[model samples]
Target: MPPHAPRRRARTRRSIARLRSASIDAFAIWRRRLLFLVGGICVGLAAVFMAKLADAAQAAFRQILAISPLLALVVTPAGFGVAALLARTVFPNSQGSGIPQVIAARHTHDPALRHALISLRVAFGKIVVMALGLASGAAAGREGPTVQVGAAIMAAFGRLTPQRLPGLILAGGAAGVAAAFNTPLAGIVFGIEELGRTYEARTTGLIVAAIVAAGLTSLWLVGNYTYFGTTDAGLALGGSWLLVLVLGFAGGLAGGLFSRIVILFGRGLPGRAGAWIGRRPVAFAMLCGLGVALCGLASDGASYGTGYEEARAILHGDAAARLDFAPLKFAATVLSSISGIPGGLFAPSLAVGAGLGAALRDLFAEVPIGALVLIGMVSYLTGVLQAPITSFVIVTEMTQDHAMMIPLMIAALVADAASKLVCRGGLYHVLAEQILARADAPAEPVRRTA
Candidate 1:
């Protein structure tokens, strides 16, 4: 027998163990990546599903209007009432824009609480209720609700593995924005500026990977296209720049007021009025629906649905947007939002901005209408979300207009300041806090259904 035989066998055993350890580690890493990739693809598909649903709903509602413009008074209120009832009873956490619920889920430590906020059930309810609202001609957007749905899907996937990654929810949300708008860069910016509030190096890969996957999926289905189309509008630093200042400040203040009203309603109205709304939320939702119907009448059906077509036309200089469309759209969006129906504010806000810009286009006839429209968009969006970078990036990506970046950035800054003057808190963050408070104080006489 050779003495070296024992040492050789030991070395072989060590090599085998090392290979096994490396294989296990590699498998785990690959599994996590696969989850993220699959989750991202799912999010993209969900975005497409949601967009198609919203489009079909709006088309159906338009047909109803063709039959009789006044029919919305009945259809809208009745539909809003049902949506509110379902949100209250069957989907307690599926009310409003759904962005708030995602934000709340991110902040919460309790797994159960987060589950309640961004669960599969809540995601399904969000889709159904949001579609119903759109079908009823409610002035709302689907983009925001898409964020919640994406987050829920990603969170559910996260639970499949023993090692839970906290940023999966955030990544999912960012991916949703990417797929919904086909704007990958804006998704990254939103994930950093709006959702996570800070850059996480570890999750950056996950975020980018998810965004790319989702964007590819959406592009494959919907084809490559900009949200607002291409524009050659530029803002030189001269007399035309003054429009930026004027429109920026005005849009910001208006956007700020919108956010303030929403927050106030979310906290419930003051005293007896609040109590009354609390007791009969479904009825109040119906009232709000009626208000939206009136806005629709005033706008000649322009204020219904997501306001996407209206905004797109105005941006492209194809439509003579009504002078009062901005304010009416604003009122309708606020009413739909406070009614506690499931819908998003992004498209309606842009519609209001487009109308506002069109209204001011006469005053600045020398300025390019596209420039004013672009400025109005950045200003108002920045004001609503209090996320300047996200707002500018999204508008830039949507319009595919790099020439307006400088003015848009400046406008966003101005809007951010003006918005803070009216409403100190960001809309989603404030709503998220209220959600947390309600969850913590469940015994309190808080109206979750509303």
Candidate 2:
């Protein structure tokens, strides 16, 4: 061979060797990553199972209470006390709504802070506490605790895997919401809009898979039924379009105020009276339960448990027996939420909005009640979550009302914008800030020195 030809052949061989080495390295890295990914999937599925089981348990328990509202009020609160103790001691970070904790977990860089597991303790604690809150007429929903429980299960498995665990945890959290509420599409939307922060194809797939699995699991166990009974949800259209727009604007304002009040009242120290109440949660819960029971006595137990039943009654153009109990419901929910007793704001928020909407429907007989309630649902949820698309899809799907699409979309946008104007941070962000502050307060010296 010529000298030049020999040199060229040697260089080609060297180049080929380098390429092969690089390919092997890439394969090794991918193989490891694939193993981690599989681990995440397993973690996610386990989370789905736990979340579904918890949801089923809570629903069954609540159904039993539904048969006797007063007993539910008393018994549930006592259970809440036990759950609260477990949560406060075991996974304090998991207390209250899971959304804030999840946000903190995702945003915080400290692995230790993020290392907190979504364990069985947190799950069962939240479930019992939320049940108690609901039983005692706490103005809260079960979805929040279920989400925490779901994330805890996911986190357990996520801890076994690599850094990609947060994504899996988020997917599982969303699935829990879907399973608990039996709103799969909403769960997917919530994962993207609220938890994922920014959507990517991989995250989307994980969330979608988790939601589909959990939703199917829940449906298989519980059968299909909207939390609230089905409604007409059709828009009257024509002249009333303007009215709907106005309502949307108003609803947005209401939602913003509601969120603000919750964060403010929840965080600010309430002086001696507040301290006294906080100190005696059990007694306070009992008193509140009694108060709710007394007020509910008038209407033969009309306002109770997530407010869906009453909202349904209102949508049907029938007066709720305890129409006057809306205020009581609001008060109980606010207290339970502020007490950090493991519950969600969404159900209470929806109930409050629906109640207001139903009242408006009564006041304005010309508009469709279903449309009003749908608008209210979106308006309130968007205002608080600041996730217009998620809120919109959730309510729209719940009603399956294509005709009200325009109004629902419009309402969601207006409410989101208006709520933003009032508070730059959404409700979850506000709560997360408070949680972080509380977590960091004691470590301030260490952080400052560092």
Candidate 3:
């Protein structure tokens, strides 16, 4: 061999050796991470199961009070106050949907950490707030807080441990929702498609596991009922398909309007009354309580809670003066929602869409109310979340009716498109913007080390 060839071969060998060493180091680090993740998943799933039990307890408590909504409404503020204080004191990062927190955490581009408060206190606070909010006629749902509760439980179990990557967090998040709502596949889909923002093979497995774990937890406690008791009235075929198209169009328009109005109020109220309310949360909550109480008295306690009864009424085609009540329910719900009382918009949104759908179905007099209600659900959900596929899937899953798939797809697509045209952000995104904007406000500079 030439002298130069021998020298080049030696150089190549050293380079290859260096590469091999680097690869080995990377693998070692990855293995440790993998091990930690497996441990976190075990810990997180356990926590999720426990939280589901707590949530079940809360649900039972709410049901007991639901028998006397007026009196129950009064008790909600106390719950909210305690929850708010705990949340502020303990898991401040856990405030709101907490979807944003996990989303932010997943982004390597973002630099932040969970404090001791977020893992324990925040989750508890959310539970208290959510329960109280539900009791008090807050036009919100429990899913968001429950999701946080699950995440917090996971974080607590895995504390002092190296951070799991975004995938684990996403898995935990999915499990949280699955456990809360008793919808495992939806939870899996939500984790992979909605929250995780990917459907890769690896992510699908982790999320599916988490969802299964969560669903098992929920089924053990809550029984396997869908959140809404949607009727299985078959979808209209042939001539009725036209009605579905009409419902889809109508739902899209209504959903778009609802989305716009929420944004308008959420933004307009701010810069004016929000600061005042912030200064006097107790007073604002009291006023809200009174307003909700008065609404109950006016409607003879009809316009309260998550609108479950109203939804049933719509489903049965037994609604009387529902059109008039729709506006009131919408107003009450929107105000309660914007007031920052801990609740979920999911149920309220569903209720709103149902009311609208029922009204339209009555007007048409040809289409089945069930079909319209389902369309309305997809419409409003698509508009709010701007996730037509998720919305449609959730509605279909909730109702367990495959016949309306075509109509749902049509309505969802239109509603999402319309919402996008009118609004710059989806429901959670708008909320997230407010949250991050609040968080990202320039912190007072600390003195630098020399």
Cα RMSD to the true fold for all candidates: 3.6, 5.5, 6.9
Give stretches of model 2 more than 4 Å off. 1-80, 135-137, 219-232, 274-295, 316-325, 421-424, 441-450
Best by lDDT: 1
On TM-score, the leading prediction is 1
lDDT per model vs. reference: 0.90, 0.64, 0.61
Q: Clashes in each model (backbone N, CA, C under 3 Å)?
A: 0, 6, 2
Tens digit per residue, CA lDDT, model 1, 331-418: 9999999999999988888888888888998899988889889899889888898888988899999999999999999999999999
Model 3 ranges with Cα > 4 A deviation: 1-91, 108-118, 157-163, 253-272, 316-321, 441-450
Cα lDDT over the full model 1 = 0.90
The ten-residue window of minimal lDDT in model 1 covers 441-450
TM-score of each: 0.96, 0.78, 0.76
**Candidates sorted on TM-score, descending:** 1, 2, 3
Q: Score candidate 3 by lDDT.
A: 0.61
> The CA-based lDDT of model 2 is what?
0.64
User: Considering lDDT, where higher is better, how would the candidates rank from best to worst?
Assistant: 1, 2, 3
lDDT of 3 by residue, 168-264 (tens): 5666666766665556666766665555556556555555655665666556555678766656765656676665556556656655666566656
